[model samples]
Target: MQERIPRRTLLAGLGAGLVLPAAARAGDLAAAGWASARGGEGGRTLRVTTLAPDGPGSFRAAVEAAGPRKVVFDVVGVIDLGRKSIRIREPFLTVAGETAPSPGITFIRGGIQVESHDVVLRHLRVRAGRDGAPDRSGWEVDGITCWKAHDVIVDHCSIAWATDENLSASGPRFDGGDTVEAWRQGTSRRITFSNNIVSEGLSHASHVKGEHSKGTLIHDNATEVLIVGNLYAHNLERNQLFKGAVHAVSVNNLVYDPGTRAMHYALNAPEWEGRAWQVGQLALVGNVIKGGASTRPDLPFLIVEGQGDLDLYARDNRAAYADGRPMPELRVLPTTPLPKVRRLARPPLWPKGLKALPASAVEASVLATAGARPWDRDAIDLRVLRQVKDGTGRVIDDEKEVGGYPK
Candidate 1:
């Protein structure tokens, strides 16, 4: 249990920019990893009074309001987005979906896009389905994507049915300044995607690029990313892919039913045609990957592709088939082989207080704590978790296969 600190003292320390201790971090479950230090500490409260996609008291309205604020919900159930996303451009904001009623709040037909800094999002569910759009109609939506955003934490949310990557950190690969470090800083950095349930991304849906049932894409140049304690299920590929120049740590995640691919790294040559190549640095520790019905046979834990190089550190990552048979740890594409995918003796970067659970314990821990309102899970989330346990889910083309949206 978390010991309570006085509101006065907490605010005072926040104002003083004091790094919170582990006990203090426990007070707010959303505070963890690289993003644990700062967020909307002294913000005004903004209440979401309706489930409408947009209006005076809608979720969209509260997020778009000026200044630092913590958005709380007065209503629950789904917010039909009319197949359009809500863009959050303000800095120092907290969207506290856990403050809602028992069922909590859910967004359908669209998702949230974070384009600012110092943001904390928790306990929300974004079901960004195709919304009856024709296949290849270019209606790509992500279940909470951060673009060039920093000091952000997205925790315990349920994301599914996305046409594109479910939860991604993406931006201009090279921007801001002259040096490589400056370019990395210009994009999304210091972001945490933790304890979330990312599942059932729509395969052969409304994406313009054809089949794109992806999990999470840490885009090129994004840095200081921490992905821990999340459940990735029934996604076709990109079960969290790290592009070139990305520095990320993925630990203790439970991945199930990832078809053809589990975790991957790639750096497109055309995307960096004229510029110098940047190597991706990644550390995968204590993660559990179990193949399901949709998964192909003899798939390794990771597949590296594209033209750029990668420095990787993998430890205690367990991969198994549905029948409990072991699988390989790493496989590079034949096109990009050998030294292009270098194995690192030590981790490239490690967060200050990240405690990765053992691979054997990842499944139980994530199933119990991941996703929105785990104590009061929605029907869809419950079904997904059950299928994960039974090794019985598939990559679907539509949400209707899983009974569509919740009431």
Candidate 2:
């Protein structure tokens, strides 16, 4: 029973104020061969090796026969539901579920549910249905839901076991009284979860407590956002009650042995009304934080308790703290020194009466040497003059000779 039009009659049968040419804009190539010939008859564009034979309902009847617009799913391998069990039911839309309300794929129990929108699930490998669980209906419900999806891309996939957590959505479920019921709804914008490899569900593992899972970019989703090079060796109370609010950008990831004793970052907003923890721009760069001695003496690679203006940045890291304690004050910044004089707008190619030296004679030969300062402008790697500094060092004269010029 799915045929309810009238979103202005599906934008007037998609000819709503039309305009095409300039090679049919929208990622050109004649608008992707007119969206792969409206997605059928050797459908011109939906590669993943041109998947057919009815699955994802022949990719939702090849995106409603590619008529509407914007289709690009270049997933090169693994669309094997060999042990068949792929379900996506519900009002579904796609474009990443309408700008990103979360769910390129999801399935939460109770008579199974699924949704879609502006979809783009790349390099696919969606598993989770080896036939296990259903005494009261749980594991074995292959999921994928997306609402309000826009510009969504779950790239380079390998989404595993998934009793849960490849993509999530939340809001609603406090029924003691009052009027509210939102066990994860929508709102996702410009979403892009690149280089994926999500894992979970050894035996019914997909537990996500809610608070409207925030905007994410979760770069390199290490084992499904376990954080840093993914390493979860055994369920230590669901990896210490895994939480989320994530305004993410977490880089290089490698959260290895975090069974407990470490890993805690909370800012509870008492069910969203008090609404605290709002991390805007965070960029933890080049990570490699090793086990902090079983982790929980007071874990904090980062922990903000809400307010706003949270613009953090951590560079070239390599932390360690498994009870050998001594790594706090995680507010580092001081490693700037590398210039000495190297600015060439144009001038290079030796021997022809070579004479190209003046930036005030390389700043008076680096202020006459000796721990050269004067804001040591960096860039001078003149092979440290072949290191032969004996006669109490200090020599550059020859009229401040710089590129081949000492006759």
Candidate 3:
């Protein structure tokens, strides 16, 4: 946390999130960090599953074959697990779903769990069937859960119908009677949640939370998360939840058909009571949110209710209601004047990279390119994808969209 400065000091450029060398960064630092996510490059490629027991055979077998070394495995067929899930424990692993034989790996039941560092998941589709309790207990399933994990990227996949959350990156809890130290949960750091379709989740579409044991939530411990260029749809609440984060960036994303709330940014000092992230260096720019037809009927565009102080900044984010009318600026309570941009992704994810397209363009691209490949856009109703044009005068459609594995 940065030390507080008097209003006069801020006028002289001495505020917490305001004092920065103007020439330190060039162009969009958030976009560069997001583009530099390369998973399992040093590992050997092992082809697995799809009917005929080919090269490395089953997904589990190939991962075990890699042993402790970083391995890149191409899932070449459909894996129909009845009520099970696969957890990748090895660090530096990549699961390329584009290599799958047909529509990519479709989990009629199971899901993928990356509990390791330097991991990447792309070009896959996970469908958690209805009545989402695999254990026959209360619904608490996630399409992908990165617990106590770091240096990961989840991209170009379509995940749907999770009872709890579709995607989540949370630290494990530190046991201490009832209440536990949030910072002491785990050393989970340097993760990117981007370029994927996380929709139809019963709870939060995505959860970027830390370990909250008792009633008191601690977000001062979660750090270095980059969320970019993805489509969030049909979630019960929090299409994108920024409960607590030390240094987080959300850019060029679209939220369609929101259920409860669209997004939240709560940054205060010390402890942010109920959320799970610490607000260190925050950058929230170029986000598009909409629902209904000319009205955003979910909750609010974003909720800024916490008071724990940290470097906070938000800009270029627009929202529309269900009636398709433009919504007003966000309401940030105990409002601190909008801060300036600062680069926190040092040695960025992509030192020489690019950002996702603009939200107007991203909405069409996400819907067109999301889901498995070989999908007939002519078959599905175009209205389902939120095909709306923006001020840029570009028709939102499947013209330059990109996702999934190329045939």
Candidate 4:
């Protein structure tokens, strides 16, 4: 006689523990942009019927023409561009390109700039294509940039290969000097950065540069950011730079093969500059950093190269070392403290619907969904898919290769 084991128990033991939390369902995910942007939900629909970069019925024209209307301009085909950047100065708008006929708009020499509040940009692909001139040319610029805008959301978009940063949120500021009541500058607020692929930036992956700088846009006061569920890869450094900001929450992001630095939270204000050196706030939670065997030690799981006074709080961050083992701790791997550190006592504000998935789950979810894509687009070319986790290539837009949501 043999003892029979229960089928349910056996099946449970065999499971690989791969599950998407019910709280993070697709319906909830779709509404995140609207919620974050204070109802930037793009009330009306303005279908873009062509691939023209910036003329009649084009993306730029529709957005510029849309006055006093909370409209969504849905792009239906891949729109190519030359030297002119698509600039938007309106409020309460949505630009959707998830259903483009081709891989979406490929920016050979231009990018986009949003300068208003309550805006949503979804499932669009803006890549500074590889070609003639050097990357130093200012014309080969950022994918999407915002200045002093608030309650904005960027989701499921793939932006890459920019001479500057792939994405930036900045505004203007004055260098506060010897005492006449120091005042704040044009600072952006309540901005959500999530569910996207930002990579191959020549200088930085994402630049949140604010304060007294030469940058066209500099937002120094009251900049609060919600950054989560994104994929950062193949960028040289500055995965996310907090040059001048007060609050930012970084969670559940997958950083695959970052170069010199994972993040730079600094007060770039020079010694002769303003009192802005004493401003910063950041929190790192549940982020997974997967580095190759060749990654340098200085660029560890995370690094701090800013003024020691920068307020930083880190927890539950995991890293895969060069030898392919989980890093035991998330301590600064340096031999000496760059400067006497300043750890924050208060934690960052967690958004309403953010769920903390495991490091593995987060990586998988980002890999499957981040970029000019849904969770179901992955029929990639061998040249691209081979380096999807590390190097840069033609990111395939085939939703068929992707599996179910967070499977």
Candidate 5:
């Protein structure tokens, strides 16, 4: 008779061999140009300049020169204040017959481009030229772009002001044509972006393209994003009007402010279709939002707009209005456990010596967080489920149930 390998036993065997001592694995991975799996110390740090002889252009050259593997851009404390104002001499010539408008900076030719892996961009300030043009045109070049890269990090950078709302001479009416053409195309994955500021950068007047921009984490862009505490303000018109497919995770992010009028609004316009088809499950928790002063408003603390069914789980969110009037309806739902759906019917075996456990293991764990087991009833917060008239309502105890809380 063949020996029956217990599932747990098989898992332990697979998981055992791959577990390497942290120090040894760290050294090996580091030498191989891979990030330290254990987040170890003693790694090489490469610094590159983003301006001047060793500026953004030079930085690109340096990356090509240094070759890839465990590199850091070290862009902290780099500011370009030399060019006080970027004046467009022939503004009238660009837009003939119409009123000539002044834009601060102009990128007539090639824009900025970047290609690297495991990169970090920090502490850089990019703004509109100080000519006081009606439109604050900052950098005429294509905005900071990353191409064919993975595990990239963009932090503490500021991008604001741009040339024409619409790049074409036709003006802002026909979708900011000039602005639309400015975006660069590339493939990026596993990106972590935080504490950066972006404001007045892309004009609301431009038309946008590219449908494959995916897998991004946009958070803590408070300064130029304008709202406050990682809020996303400005570009409301363009954000609302854009139609593209973006797969991203937005968490603990503020979307608006009170002094600026209302509290919160959708990141995208209702007309736009972002992540319409391939939107993954979104987890929105602990978000605070306020609505505009308008009598009829569309402001919601959490708005997941797009196609496809979204298994969205929102908890501990506050949504209030400016008016003293009481809220008519607050749409809150009870936590419901999702049915298990495996990406692959059969579990993939771990590489030899890799872990192999019951296929349902991770799923069972995730379901617990969603209030799955009978014991989870005590853990579920009723405040997030139903709105009761009084804090202490009558407690009804019937036959004990064996499912999600409140069963």
Candidate 6:
């Protein structure tokens, strides 16, 4: 699932949702960075009255409605997508899963993709399993992803069982841009992926690329992406990857049992063979990564792979093994070639009024408040959290391994 639309094309297609109010409320942004901008404020209320994927009063209908809208839900249960996804094309929208009755809402066998601007998604669960699709059958689904979408905030969501990434912000690498700044503006910008539980991306399940289990991919040219206070558990690799020319921040995140790698940066030579190479900038602060049963030995806290130059600022990041043994902070595998890593004196893009918790406090803080409706967690979420605490889980090939969805 790629979004290849050029920047100009996307701008030309903007509709009534682009006409947003001038002043945004302070509460809308609180902890999020540039993405703190308001979404659907002073807009119409559209209630999701059914668990259907489409038709009247369904989630699809509410999201597809024109203009700025705030989506509230009266229904609470698992919304079986029947193996399809809900693409949010309308802008200035807020899907507040917290507005639903008791149990809240969960989407099974499908996912959500944000392709518009000024969107806020909160307190939702998305478990996009393979649904018995054949191995390598191209049945790829992301829990929630944003592409060519800006000013978006996806917070406190429980996302799992995806054949692809559990959560990500991605788009075209370069959309006919003459300079580096133009390239960044062409893709997703000002996005916040905060306080989410991204886990168990299905390995060897349904992606066309075999054995691809990833947590998040902040693709090339994506700018101003803030990944904070999230719990990334049981994904094989790409606990989060910053591709070429991207600007991102990873702070106060708890990563457990990442198989081969934890956090990495790469820019493939083939992807930018003839184009001008743009440098990626990243800030890593107060984060924690712990190796578990599935993790390989001597894994670095941060790995720079393939081609491309990167400017990085690292401070107070910590790593440990399953049994509480400390690990190297910047150790790389002996055979792996390193990319050009330039050190920065200070953070280039820190969020406003953001005070990162100490690395020692990351695990407790993330586990307690991360994911959708932390007060009312489901069986699968509780199981994953327990495994992370006890060091007892590995990446799986199917949701059946953990007992499929709830009845």
Specify the highest-lDDT model's number.
Answer: 1
In candidate 5, what are the lDDT values of residues 1-407, reduced to their tens digit?
01123344333323232222333211111111111112102333334434332335333333344423222333322224333322211100010100111111111112223344444433333332222222223333323343433344443333333232210010111131332221111333344333333323233212132111111122111101111112222222221111122223333333222222212212232332231232233333333333332223543443333222333443444445545333322222222322221232222211122221122232221111111011111211122111110112111111011111121
User: Candidate 1 vs. truth: CA RMSD?
Assistant: 7.1
**Collision pairs in model 1:** none
Superposed Cα deviation of residue 343, candidate 2 (Å): 28
* CA lDDT of every candidate: 0.84, 0.28, 0.50, 0.54, 0.26, 0.83
User: Which candidate tops TM-score?
Assistant: 1
User: For candidate 3, lDDT tens digit of each residue in 156-190?
Assistant: 56666554456776664332233324453464556
Give all candidate RMSDs, comma-separated: 7.1, 27.1, 12.9, 8.8, 20.2, 9.7
After the best TM-score superposition of candidate 6, give how far the Cα of residue 396 lies from its true spot, in angstroms.
Answer: 0.5
Q: Which residue runs of candidate 4 sit more than 4 Å off their true CA positions?
A: 1-43, 68-75, 99-107, 175-185, 203-222, 325-340, 344-346, 375-407
Candidate 3: misplaced stretches above 4 Å? 1-38, 50-56, 64-77, 131-136, 173-185, 203-220, 267-280, 293-298, 332-356, 371-407
Q: Candidate 6 residues 1-407, lDDT tens each?
A: 01123333323222111111111111132256778547788899999999988999999999999888899999999999988899999888988887888678999999999998999998899999988888999999998999888999998799999999889998887775778777788889999998889999999998999897899999998988999889999999999988888899999999999988799888876797578777889999999998998888877788887667788999999988887777776643232345678889999778777788778777766766677776566777778887877788999999988898766
TM-score of each model, paired residue for residue: 0.91, 0.23, 0.67, 0.75, 0.40, 0.91
User: Sort by lDDT, best first: what order?
Assistant: 1, 6, 4, 3, 2, 5
Candidate 2 lDDT over 1-407, as tens digits, reads 01122234322322322222322122111001001112112224432223343455344444444333333443322233333443332211222211111112221121111233334443233434323343224333322323333233443333333343333322122222332211112333333343333322233232233111111122111111212222222112122122323333343333322323222223234444543333333444444433422344544444333222334444554445554454452422222221112222322111122122222222122212111110111112112211211111112211122232111
Clash statistics: count for each candidate:
0, 61, 28, 8, 16, 0
